[model samples]
Structures are given as structure tokens and as C-alpha cells.
Target: MASERILSKVAEEQKKHALNVAMATTAAAEAAVAAAQAAAEVVRLTGAAESCQRFRKFDPNLAAIRIQSAYRGHLVSPS
Candidate 1:
């Protein structure tokens, strides 16, 4: 029957549409995951850079103090 054939055709089209929608959803999920990973990497690297900067700022002061202490030790020691 023609009605049966039409119903079959409609069912096939619906199936294809559903598959397309599912594929699109999967792609969107993958893109979101990748973006989240990238953001996390940026945060980690920024934290590391800030920590290095803090240590760099401390290192020069520490070196100067060590140098001054060494000079004082030399002055106190006998010739």
C-alpha cells in the first residue's frame, strides 16, 4: 500500500535526523571538554609562573644577606 510506503519513508527520515542530532551533540561535548582542558592548563602555568616570580624576588635579597654575613665573618676573624 502507498500509505505503508509513505510511513516507512517518514520513519527512515526520522532515523537519519536523530542520528545527525546525536552526532552534533557528541561533537559539542568533545569541544567543551577540550576547552576545559585548555583553561586548566592556562591556570596551572600561570600559577607556576607566579610562584617562580615570587622566588626570584626573594633570591636576590637572600644572596645579599649571605654576602654581608660572609664579610662580617671575615672582619671578625684574626689575620
Candidate 2:
């Protein structure tokens, strides 16, 4: 009687604790994934910036040349 009631109460408390722990674990995992994504983005941006700087060091006028060529082509193209 009384023991059964106590057992039922204990089971309910255990279930609540398990649920809270699971929720906390899920939140932590989500935070970790977000942090990883942010780190990856930082790395990607850094790589892009470095590549641009390297390209400029090698040939700074390459992009300007391409743009001029495109403009000349456009000018010659019949409209």
C-alpha cells in the first residue's frame, strides 16, 4: 500500500530526471554543432581571403584585363 505509493513516486521522479538530462544533452549537442559550423565558416572565409591576396600578388592586373576585354567585346558586338 504505502510502499507501492512510494515506489510510484520514485518512478515518476526518475522519469522527470531522465527527461531533464535528455533535454540538456540535446541542447549541448546543438550548441556544439553550431560552434563547429561557425568555425568552419571562419576557416572558409579565411581561405578565400588568403587566395585573393595570393592571386593579387601574382598578377594584380588579371582581373582588370578580363574586365577590359569583356567591355571591348561588348562594344564590338552588334546590338
The per-candidate count of clashes, in order, stands at 0, 0
Per-residue CA lDDT of model 1 for 1-79, tens digit only, reads 9999999999999999999999999999976865665556556655655566766565645434544555555456664
Query: Which stretches of candidate 1 lie above 4 Å from their native place?
Result: 54-79
> How much does each candidate deviate from the true structure in C-alpha RMSD?
20.7, 15.4
Instruction: Report model 2's TM-score to 2 decimal places.
Output: 0.63
Kindly list the per-residue Cα lDDT of model 2 for residues 44-64, writing each as its tens digit.
Answer: 655655567877777767555
- Model 2: lDDT to the true structure: 0.71
> What is the Cα-based TM-score of model 1?
0.64
Candidate achieving the largest TM-score: 1
Each prediction's TM-score versus the true structure: 0.64, 0.63
Candidate 1 worst ten-residue window by lDDT: 62-71
Each model's lDDT? 0.68, 0.71
- Stretches > 4 Å off in candidate 2: 54-79
